[model samples]
Target: MTLPSRNIFRYKTETRQSMHSLSPFMSDDVVPGVNHSPVKAPRKVPRSPYKVLDAPALQDDFYLNLVDWSSHNVLAVGLGNCVYLWNACSSKVTKLCDLGVDDCVCSVGWAQRGTHLAVGTNNGKVQ
Candidate 1:
């Protein structure tokens, strides 16, 4: 959804079974830290004041549950049993993981001390 803040849009998921968070610094080689939670998400684009830098066709996977952004990349999970890491700048697809959770993610978090992440799920589990 477009926020009243203008130029700010909120993206949510459709099948929020699990949410994930990735630190921006880890990637392309290292696994980086991941956090999971219960949340259904699909690729989607809410109205934005600024021109969307990415392709317009990706508005379908709006995440409804939880998402996290580090200094670099973003992580999200849905009911698809797979985790996704997105590039914040170019709106590019980065990492995908079939964690086998196969449920819903409720929330995601970035570790303040480091580049790690934490994920929460409705199944009463944390990863």
Candidate 2:
């Protein structure tokens, strides 16, 4: 008992014909009610960073947030036992504080007004 051979070409032609009869747009050229204007490509973006800062002994701990950007465009970074403040506008780096050899900076944060910065140390102290 052998099954009848199927004609793939004939099946595809029938399917195409049925689809063309059902849809208003038969050909692949254009849709029945749509504009076919050329679309503008997006503008190219710079691959490199605008600026870079050298941060020595910056902690790579997952739970610690050692870097923070203030609303006044100041960047606070905790590097080992010292916390430094970098002004984005002037590009000036200032030494905010040093926790000394006994303590290491854990995290750094800026105040809401961006006028003050808080530094947390591993010795359970906040400066």
TM-score of each: 0.39, 0.66
Best by lDDT: 2
- RMSD (Å) of each candidate, 1 decimal: 26.9, 8.3
**Over 4 Å off, model 1:** 1-65, 73-80
Question: TM-score for model 2?
Answer: 0.66
Highest TM-score model number:
2
Evaluate residue 99 in candidate 1 and report its C-alpha lDDT on the 0 to 100 scale: 52
Query: What tens-digit string does per-residue lDDT give for candidate 2 at 1-127?
Result: 9877586455544444343455665666555466566888999889997887789778788989899999999999999888889999999999988888999989888999999888888988888
How far residue 83's Cα lies from its native spot in candidate 1, in Å, is 2.4
TM-score of model 1 vs. true structure: 0.39
